[model samples]
Target: MFPLFAARWDRSDLTASLTLFTGLMALAFCLVHLFVGQLRFLDRNPRSRWLSFSGGVAVAYVFLHMLPELGANAGAFHRATGLDEVMAESAVYLLALFGVAAFYGTERALKRSRGQDKDQIEQARPESSVFWLHIAVSSLLMFVIGYLLNHREDTSLIGLALYFFAMILHFVTADFGTRGDHPELYDDRGRWILSAATLAGWLLGTQLSVPEIAIGGLFAFVSGAIVLVVLKEELPEERKSFFLPFAGGTLLYAALVLSEQALSA
Candidate 1:
């Protein structure tokens, strides 16, 4: 199905059918991660690692094997078409927003069945620095995979697969590290806004070919800063457990960004 789409449409010197497919898969992976994370899959440190590994493998397989072949044949099959990058990005953003809304709806339905309290939804259980470390490592992997996919004109299918695999792993790690107490208040509007913003950021990063480090760093900084601010208002007993992942994610994002900047310089 993807190949047929590639054969019919996509024509950038660099954008092959495989590349498009992989890119779409990457977006799908992100959405899945977001959904699962929201559902509290990474509540435990060990489980986070497993999820990260599984996600990474899934992403890597698509990038390494699927992308390269499509890229190599990109020119022979399709002619360059001046499709709007902005429009495409917008579409992805919209998709992400929709996904979040759908997830929230599902969650609400589940809560009704379980008789969960509207104001006291259980937050993500806390984990050790080990979990944070895993997240940091996975983020680094995302940087590498993004870089490789963006820079290479012609990559092997195997290589693309590995890259995507690493990316999913990275997401799992981040998801694990940042598991927080589910908010007591279900703010549908707030969730929708955040989802839209996240999707926009994601689309911009991919469309602009922003360095992976920069993108990751920005995510880390923003998410960490939000967490830290939230902690300031929490009870003393609640502060300790939540801080590590926020700090770790922030540090990792900063490190990756600085490292990349330095190397570029």
Candidate 2:
């Protein structure tokens, strides 16, 4: 009886440790956007190599980890939803495509807003309505990220750490881009709202339980958004981003991920 009780206590302690780690990671996610405005060094004509490096890391995670996970999750999604195998298999990818399209549409609208507003010529901020629309979408993404802090399929510490690093870098790049687009508004209200959305997501995840299929779908959407946002930030001609750092980051992360998989296998 004492041995059984000791085993139960050990399991309880492990659960507590994991819960604390996830909560702290969620807080870090909230803090990244809340204070990302201070990273003014990234705002340069000759673009920051760090941003390119971050983009590379994000791309690596999406392609190597998240996309493969989506494929693996497809079978479970099919089983849960009672849909045809083909439709269920393809559903997550369709959600990912929609995520890309949604962000692209918002990007075009922001550009249009800037172009039409001659009065705000110097600042080049998007109009107020458009700014909120962009913020809403961005915040939704943040919320999903925060929710996944708890719901992520990999409950191990190493898995959570990798997720945290990939996402924190992605957040920095995203915050930089949005802050540039809405210079006045992002710092004033946008970052605060995003930070809150992240916290809100964590709170919801703690309080409410959702189906695994729904969580998988949200994960796929975020994977798509991350890919689009990273490319949009890096691929602009005027940014003059570096290639070496980007390649280095990609190779380094890929090697680490592959090694991790090998060790686990």
Candidate 3:
């Protein structure tokens, strides 16, 4: 939790400013969905092609852009921290894997608890008082995501835009998922906690600057979580995913990412 506040934004750096602006806007867009969840047409279309497209775009970002960037960051981590080269590389990848597993584990636990609560209420058992626990845990995870987005400086406006597009959809699905599990809690307190936590994380991340290695590693961790959460939404057995739209989104955004990298190269 070292402060990264010293690296003040240079007003001349328009690209950074614009990217930062878009990042803020994207967070606002997600926050809006928490209130307007059911009002959207997409909510009715759970299997909407847009979901698959967004999932695909998200998948492409992690695999093509985030992973490669993390590989380089791992190398930097090795140099900056003076870790063993092989071990640093291994650790970096492991962090990504760990992110995926951690998110999956959390989601599973939450879903199970939600189910038990529902069942207990049905049986007329005392209503589960674990609503605050869910709000806390989900808020923490989302806070990390917002913080990591602030750390993603390597991305250009276009890349961030695509990322923003994907995550907006990602949050929408997350809202629906949570609502499905605990309708009352999500309606009353859960969404507010998430919005506050995420916005707070972004504000904190912007104000505090950490070491390069920490930034790189944190970004890698978020990448892993992104992959996990996106795939969970799109690749479940019960959910019907539109394959063509999915692939179309995957290829289109993958090409966009690769092309940008190529141009910058």
TM-score of each: 0.34, 0.89, 0.80
- Tens-digit lDDT track of model 1 for 48-74: 434433433333333333333333323
Q: Which stretches of candidate 1 lie over 4 Å from their true place?
A: 1-12, 38-41, 44-149, 152-154, 181-265
* CA lDDT of every candidate: 0.38, 0.80, 0.68
Residue lDDT tens for model 2, 131-188: 8999999999989888877777666556667788888888888888888887678888
Better of 1 and 2 by TM-score: 2
lDDT of 3 by residue, 1-265 (tens): 2123122344234345754665675467556547745645556444777667777877877788778887888887798878898888887888788777777776766656545665353223122455465456567767876776666655455556666766676676666655555667777777777888788777776677677777777777777877888888888765688899889988998887776656555
Ranking by TM-score: 2, 3, 1
In angstroms, how far off is 144's CA in candidate 1? 11
Any residue pairs clashing in model 2, and if so which?
none
lDDT of 3 at 182: 65
Query: Between the candidate structures 2 and 3, which one is better when assessed by TM-score?
Result: 2
Among the numbered candidates, top lDDT falls to 2
Model 1, residue 50: what's the lDDT? 45
TM-score of 3: 0.80
TM-score for candidate 1, please give it.
0.34
Leading candidate by TM-score: 2
